[model samples]
Target: MKKSSIIVAFIILLISVGWILSGQIPKKIEEEETDSSLNNITDNKIELVKVRTEKSVSKKFNKLINIQGQTKANRMISISSETLGRIIMINEKKGEKIEKGDLLFKISQDELKIRIDENKARLSSARSQIDERKSKLNEFEIQFNSEKNLFDKGLSSKSKFANAKANLDSARSNLDTAKSNLALVKSELDLINNELEKTIINAPFDGIMTTGHMEIGEFVQPGSVLANFIELDPILAIGYVSEKELKSFSLGSNAFITTSLNDKIKGEISYISPIAEEGTRTFRIEITILNKNFLIKDGLTTTIEIQGRQVLAHKISPSILSLMDNGEIGIKIVNKESIVEFFPIDVISDTNQGMWISGIPDTSDIIVVGQEYATIGKKVDQKLIN
Candidate 1:
């Protein structure tokens, strides 16, 4: 009786366990079916990111290389004194415009004039002495010739012939001395005249006197700075170009310049350095522009724009620019299949309206709005923009 009760209790425990498992298995299956239905509905209702796009039409653009530059005078020189003298007159003051051959300064010509006059008088005396010496030499030569003829015929004494020859030699020596003295006097006169010319300093070229003008009573020696002279006509616009862009530049190319004062002007490329600068590795360039009115000043900052090769580019607002996973700057566009695509671009130039860029299709639907939310290679709902 005890063994029968133990077997019956064990069978009752197994039956309770099986019934509990059977009820739990149906409930689990119903929950899984409900989850499957929800998943299907969610997958079918998936929506694409909506983006605002504009059809960008590429146009022919003249690519430009903009360079920061400065205006420089074509020629800058420090006018200096060439002779020692007291400044007697200042023809031009500081900031005065002058022309070539215009008198700028005048030194005391009184002393120079006196010296020149003295030299002239000495020259006259030398000439008179030369003439007298020539006459004496001619007389001595005739006498010596007569004496030699007589001596040769045994009609003149040896002592007389020798004396005549000696006198002729002395006269010739005196004549040579007089000629040398005359040359010396003439040279002295020439030197004095040169000094007189230096007393009146004239402008070497048409320019403006910037500084270094001395008072009338001030003394100046040779090599003293007289004035700062600069030529403003045909001024130079100086700038540097990178080594990579140097090949694109050529002599006589047209360039547009804008000064710090907002002066717009045109120029031509005049010079290009063959060797690059040491530290910057850039070549110096000079553009020549006419400054007839002298409006442009030296050292004024300027912007130079040089035209490059023509290329097809699209103009887009800077806000639409995007970046790729690799950190490359690009723009996002929708292809024919409505898939978002990233295109790497080269910025050709920028203006007030937008930036011009290249390296894209001739016509593309660029996602201007909602580009940040759009993923590359994913379909997007594109909305056309005006």
Candidate 2:
């Protein structure tokens, strides 16, 4: 009975092992079939990159130069005294607005009037001497004529006639000397008047006085700066341009100016430096902007927009720019063959809408989306975005 029981138990264990093996064999076959199908799909499939494109339109755009500069007064000058004297009166103060020929300061008229009066007296004395010499010359001429008539008629000695002629010549010389002295005295009087005029200083032009508060009794010399003056109307906008950008500029070109305070003004190119700056190697450009109200101050930082020639350009978002393998910045486009191409661009100007760029085809289809996946000179599957 024990032997029969052992054989039956062994048959039951063998049936369980056969059932487990039958289930695992089918599963292994299914896994192998799945792996084979995946390999077939991978081998013969083409990789396609999806990208969005836009049609570029050719349009005329203004080429512009965006630069920074500073404002300057149209005319700046240091007013200096032309003569030496002591300050007796102060007519203007610093920061005062003055008109042309306005008195700025007064120098002490030390002995100026006395000198002029002395010259006048000397002129009077010379005039009286001139009249007396002329009367004596007339008397000598009459006597000489009488002596000459006597000598010609052989009625008088040659010595007597010669003496009379010498007297007349001396009188004429005295009269000429008197006239010269009169002229000299007159010139002296004129000099004194000119010096008197120099005692008072006046403004050269219509401007604001930036300096001068000379107190009374301050001694000043020739060429001593008495005040600072500036003309603010029609202010100057000065900037520098590089060598490459020099060709785009010309005198009288129109420009737009903006101040740091968001003030926009219109201007024109006034002066272009003939020589380059020594340190920067750049040419200086000056623009004239009307400031009739004198609202603009000098030395304030400014932004200048100088318009250049009109050229064909494309305006696009800045994100569309890409970098090539050579580290060049550009945009990617689709050629006529629907293949990817690269074009380098120059940024002309930036606006609120977009960046204006040059150096692309007049008309092109540019990749807008999935541009990272697009390779230059490769076929692409372009997808347009609405």
Candidate 3:
């Protein structure tokens, strides 16, 4: 019986050892499961990313004005003749530069020269006649004085004195008439000379002449078209603005213009038409474009843009616009529970900077990147992008 008891004890001891070993098996399995779950979490973290983002708010809405326009030279003109005469010499050819008062044509001066010479001869003869009349008047004056002295001395008759005085007066009047006649002839000659000179045409301003109306010896009438000329160095851009856009445009506003002909011009508002067109309800605005290079030609189609509207917005790359679930147009935002939140924004203006949003806090930090991946109220780790 003692031996039987000893065998039972040995069996119990073996079973105890087996039980202890069996207990370790569950712990090992639990440890392996924990390690596997940790690995899985790490791998999932790579699949999703936190997109950095920013927030935008609206300040004040700015209005934009758009307009269309054409270009023209600042000064353009057609020359004309002042009198009817034959063109003697043509100084300027087509496409020639001319200064102000530059002679463009001359007329035949044969008649004018003869008229000038005749006036000179008449003036000389009038001077000689005036000298003779003056001498006669002087002699008559002396005779009248002597006759007056004789009458005062009672040695001459009153009739004789009166006759001497009358003679002096006549001579004086004749001399005056001759001098007046000479002056009139001289003035007539001057007027004719001016009229003759008017046969020659001259440039009224510095410009380029496009055409010469008459050749040498061609007779032109007064007010005939001589040539087409345009003043250089400054040009004008004529544009029309809608009535709504005219409010933003005023004198001195900066503007830019680009033409289809590969010319870029910039200028400021030079004029704004006071009256609006009754039909189109549009107003005219002008910009004086500088032509320093002399490369810009007239009548080029152009585009104009105005700056400084005082807009408040966020600068996002154009790619940031996205679609939201339930089809509501909104951007992803952050929530209290490490979750994503989305809200619709009132879009004021979409600009090169970004979308100007209303209904968002001015200080709200928004998610800019990875907005589509995270759902509303879903847990996430957010990173900031300023």
Write one digit per residue (lDDT tens) for candidate 1, span 1-386.
99999999999999999999999999999999999999998889778899999998999987778999999999999888889899888765566567889888888888889898898899999999999999999999999999999999999999999999999999999999999999999998998899889988888887788866677788999998877889988899999998877655588888889986856799999999999999999999999998887888899999999876677999999889997768899899999999999999988888998899988899999998999999999999999987
Selected candidate, larger lDDT, 1 vs 2? 1
Model 3 lDDT vs. the true structure? 0.74
lDDT by residue (tens digit), candidate 2, 104-160 = 888888688888888889999999999999999999999999999999999999999
Candidates 1 and 3 compared by lDDT, better number = 1
Candidates, ranked, TM-score? 2, 1, 3
**After superposition, candidate 1 runs with Cα above 4 Å error:** 1-58, 148-162, 240-248, 259-262, 273-284, 306-312, 332-343, 361-386
| Candidate with the greatest TM-score versus the true structure | 2
lDDT of each: 0.89, 0.87, 0.74
Of candidate 3, the 10-residue stretch with the lowest lDDT total is 307-316
Better of 1 and 2 by TM-score: 2
Q: Each model's RMSD to truth, in Å?
A: 4.7, 8.3, 16.2
Which structure among the candidates has the greatest lDDT? Answer: 1
For residue 213, give model 1's deviation from the true position in Å: 4.0
Q: Each prediction's TM-score against the native? A: 0.76, 0.80, 0.65
